[model samples]
Target: QWNILSDYFLCFLPEKQPVQIRENKRYESIKIVLSSSLSKVKFNFVLYLCENIFDRFLTFFQREEPLIHLLYHELNDLYRNVLLSFLKSDSVQQKSGQDLLNINFEQSALWISDKEIKIGRFDCERTRKLMSSLNFDEKKSFYQDVRKIYITIANYLKKNLLLNNMLLRDLQVLDHSSRTDQSSGDRIIRIARTIPNLLDDREIDKLENEWALYLVELVDRSWYIKDEYIDSNGNIQITHVASFLPAASQLRALRSMHRSCA
Candidate 1:
């Protein structure tokens, strides 16, 4: 019964599945071209982290802002920092000159646990021997190549994965910080322009007027509601909830109207 349901539900799956499978095969083929097993492992691990870092960041949803723009910056920072830290690490001190690259891949292998779906067990002894056999020039060249790959991957992520869409950028106006900022008028206009049916010219003018009034009220109330006080230990603490955007309720009403029409 499950198989029958899957067959019916996924009838058009063939249109997309083969292309993905072919892409995966091409990626695997490229990995096969890399001569060193350690290099292959490093490449695979970096790619795995690149693909999964967003999922890791999603776990912080309860603590972090729900804005996509914020997520893009935070996730990009986390990914780049991890890769940069790995590239810059030179903890194996005893080795002199380019022999820094001669260390065992075991250090790299230790990064992942056996529970993680990684490549099979690394032969640390054989890897160490292979690395140590390389001369200074060879080691230098290999290190440069690895560094280039990491940089290229980082650039690829910035271009493809991060949210650079105009609509997403305009949506930032809904965030608490942007909502309360004096300079968010343009962003608010952009949001209204993007979702025209949701906000006509008359409503946009109304919102602008409301926003001005809202900011005035917020300033007046800040002294009472948004307050900072010194504790007994002399540590300053802020205790205030940010005000919601006035445009939010309007958008919610628009959504309700669309749903009712549907």
Candidate 2:
């Protein structure tokens, strides 16, 4: 039950598959804390905070696709901003020269829209009993431990993840929205470079040239318009579809090129 959040955390893992968070040495301290007797409270509290943070953070890059437009700088910037918000929280203050500095966590951009972040389902009888058993100082110590774990997880995401794989980043060129002005042609070549044997030199050059023509076609053909209807006059009218699809087109094109040369 406590590992539910940890399971969800795996969903955020990047393509290269870094060390698993469960066995990760960086999270050793967090694991120890979770193994403690009062783990129910600690786990639930961490879960509550993490749920909110991940939900908001995901809003930046998570998308439904045939096409997933990704940029390293975009995701990296969002990750930094999320952790910075967590760090800026008064609930988890910074100790400057042994003096605790209080800067409000509520003021953090992540929590701005949330009027109050209540641990809704986690506020059960067991949790209340555990919380009530702690004295004032004990409660303070408990919260401090929880805050440390929260910050640790945030920092881990900020630093040790595997989002920088050039292949994954280069795949962004496949997105229809990213193909503007034939710019993705060079990017397609770069992607081929990232994945050895994906395309040879001549093939890469061919793909790039084809991608340029594809761009011109996407514009001329109004590829974004998928649905056509007959007007009152019986003439066909085309309407623009919202999704930037035919992202698969790039893959299909590459495959065709590969097969042609083979």
Candidate 3:
């Protein structure tokens, strides 16, 4: 690139301009050529050069906020990933600097992983397959690593967690607000009516079923509930069980799990 630019300069530079004479005359050079309108030319050239450099730099450095946001959104769809790959590669590129580089492949390899797929809904066989991908590393003391690809799938999953949690939370509130003896089976049926708005019917059914089981497990395990149930109007009423660990806590646990064995 330098050679090309130097050649262009040599060809276009006026002969009346001063020539540089070096100790190695065979390898002589000219100083940057100037014009009476040099400043204007230089200003324009600098602008052009800055833009050229910026174009190159942009793929390296993040610039304007809106542009970056748009780029990320567009890139996400184009790459159909969380843009973790871009982050990882940018990280690597920053560390490797100017001129020639010589590094061993094994040493250069980025060893961290980033992939997130729900372990919750997966069946026994599919879940087993996911476990197989983890390979049970002893060094990290974590049985599985969540990120396997260059891009960590955090951005994608974060939105999903928000969406799913919102939908489920709304359903829980609506169900609890109603004062009636809803049959155990029919409670799921109420959820069935609204599945399309929340998730695909099949997925919503699966998620709701698991959520019910989770609630049951929580009620069963609670010392407050097991020890404190009272007979109200000849009915054993177990009320006000403790909530599950907050989603933030769960996400943090998963993130810790991802980084631990890595």
Candidates' lDDT values, in order?
0.48, 0.51, 0.33
Lowest lDDT block of 10, candidate 3: 96-105
Q: Decide which is better by lDDT, 1 or 2.
A: 2
Give each model's clash number.
0, 1, 7
TM-score ranking of the models: 2, 1, 3
Per-candidate TM-score against the hidden true structure: 0.45, 0.46, 0.17
Instruction: Tell me, by lDDT, which candidate is best.
Output: 2
Best by TM-score, which number? 2
Model 1 per-residue lDDT tens digits across residues 1-262 = 4235334334433355646545476545543444344454444445545455445665655553223435534544554443433343344333322233233333454233222222222523333445465567765565555545545654565446433455555555554566567667776666556664766788778777766665566443453246788999999988554333454645563354335434
Worst ten-residue run, lDDT, model 2? 94-103
Question: Residue 124 CA error for candidate 3 (Å)?
Answer: 64
Clashing pairs in 3: 84-151, 85-151, 113-147, 114-147, 114-148, 115-147, 140-261
| Deviation from native of the Cα of residue 225 in model 3, angstroms | 40
TM-score of 3: 0.17
lDDT of 3 by residue, 188-250 (tens): 445445433433556545645654554445333452232444576776666532222212322
Candidates sorted by lDDT, best first: 2, 1, 3
Off by over 4 Å in 3: 1-28, 32-43, 49-262
Deviating ranges (above 4 Å) for candidate 1: 1-65, 69-72, 75-142, 161-164, 219-243, 247-262
Better of 1 and 2 by TM-score: 2
Candidate 2 residues lying further than 4 Å off, grouped into runs, are 1-41, 53-85, 89-139, 181-183, 219-249, 252-262
